[model samples]
Target: MTGISYRRPSSYSRLIGVGGARGDRIVPNGDLAEALERDDEWIRRRTGIITRRHASREVLVQHLAEQAARAALDASGVPAGEMDVIIVSTVTWMKMTPGLAPLLGARVGASPSAAAYDVNAGCAGFCYAIAQADAMIRSGLARHALVVGAEKLVDFTDPTERTISFILGDGAGAVVLGPSDTPGVGPTVWGSDGRKGDAIRTTHDWLEYKYADDFRDVPWPTAEQDGPTIFRWATSVAPHFAAQAIEAAGLTPADIDVFIPHQANLRIVETMAHTLGLREDAVIARDVIDTGNTSGASVPLAMERLLREGTVHGGQTALLFGFGAGLCYASQVVELPDAVGGDGEYHADAPTAMSESEEIGAGE
Candidate 1:
């Protein structure tokens, strides 16, 4: 917090690179049929999720974030020591302190003086972090910032829960934002309806469990949501944000090149697309079909997928939005960043700017 200057700079902030890392274990719809009492077709029809990935016990949330940060850093050609800020967005961090940002900054070899911290805006976290990074760069607080969104929702998932078992997944995604000569990130449009907070949240209260005479009587907390509530809210409100983002960027819906909303559900994606009246040529991300709802990680993960597949290219304008638990939401229009291989896949021999020894404890 030492960099206190808040005056607006003459230049703008642009995303230079982006990368994503998914869990190793793939869980298909068949894997959840018994637990949810639902078959593959049913799951696909309802949530449009055919499969998802669950992080193994040995893979910590920090590991996924580090991998993503490395990819983004490598793609950007930005040295770790040059990082002025590192912001990690997540709600699934296991530790109560030393938040994921610092741990990720260490793993990614970020500067010791870099401002590092975490944000927990639920599934909307990535959008929130992006907005913050944009402000920091434009306001002269930082020149280069690494923004990451990672989640290990599997740690809190209840296997037998019908609404959540088939929806949640694990993954991390990252982007490098730096000072640019022109505006690449537009003004953000965000708001939260805390009145609807209970529509999605943990099943048990941590504070209540801690003070209980018999903790065993309290069930371990797991995620739960009012499905109908979210579906209705998202479909109705997301299009408004999308339109606002496009306008804020001085563009029209037809001018938008890509649409990357949070990959929460395929149905939601399609519904929002219809509402936006997106151009036939505009690419809409459907990464959720494979990655599932990774909460805070979904937006960036989806963005990486679109870029990797060459569906969207660097310099193209993309409309990004995120909404989830706490009824929080954020939307922005940003120019796409360069991807590894001209796509988003990382090359094995690409210099990551970090020595091999420094990459230790990545998955440990």
Candidate 2:
């Protein structure tokens, strides 16, 4: 057998915020205010989700994306203007004209030349984006990379689709990536079974599937889902793929300091942690009591929460896994350094600008 080695980091992204939104969305409950036909207890037992916050579709996706980017930029000390690339990882992007990155750049004041775009691999969008950023950095094609995961699924799911509606919320999470020779996060792993891609889809109408519009044609504005099947899929594949990633990093399940599985459902989370033989007391869990499944935003949002509270302190290992929609999946291990700030670490909502500088370059 070969030896197992670990590469620890001295610093890491200082995570902050669940987009610092204005107010919390109400969780569906029995006889509670705006409770769906389904009661809270019933909803919780089945999906392990008691509540989730839905973003106002009226608010532009760029606003939430920029807010999260500001938080990551502030925490990482990376300037937005210097950012070489901005990847807005989401399936629910705004209108087709500007795409996500350009709009995000305008919102945050980044260099006009910075490359930006969007992607869709369902909830695995961030993981897909992470791999893209890593490859670009490793290949010397890019320097500072800003990764943001934002979703507004509530915009798509009408109230009738309770199976899908109550389970999703809207928010964004961001991280700044730079070239680093120093071992930082982990060598990530990506896997997919497109064979089941159609099992979960965002549109049912042929016109919708084609992503056509009245004036022109746009894709990915809204989404449709098959919730029950996807839930079963999450319970099964997420942990196994996460294990594959940990093993690739030369670490055992026990070595992981925290499990930041995507904040889709509590039952899946509870099951996956158990299957992986990890502790249930989470160092990095989505404060999902109300924010339900932000899909693409789940993992990074959880990372923000954990880092903000020092739940995942300096010098600990975290494993993050995400899977959904495309039947797509991804997992990775991250080493956390101190997120030391004066007033402890962070607050749920912040008032001023983020602390990241205006320049960008990978610091490996």
Question: How close is every model to the real structure, measured as TM-score?
Answer: 0.92, 0.80
For 38-107, candidate 2 gives per-residue lDDT tens digits of 6667677767665666654344445567677776776667688888788887766646555777777867
Cα displacement (Å) at residue 50, model 1: 0.8
Write the residue-wise lDDT of candidate 1 on 16-132 in tens digits.
988888887889999989988878999999999988988877666777787888878888998988999999999988878878798788777887899999999999999999999
Q: For candidate 1, give the lDDT of residue 267.
A: 95
Question: Which ranges of candidate 2 are over 4 A from the true structure?
Answer: 1-24, 27-36, 206-224, 279-286, 337-364
Assess each prediction's global lDDT (C-alpha) against the native. 0.86, 0.67
**Deviation from native of the Cα of residue 299 in model 1, angstroms:** 0.8
Worst 10 residues of 2 by lDDT: 355-364
Q: In candidate 1, which residue pairs get closer than 3 Å at backbone N, Cα or C atoms, i.e. clash?
A: none
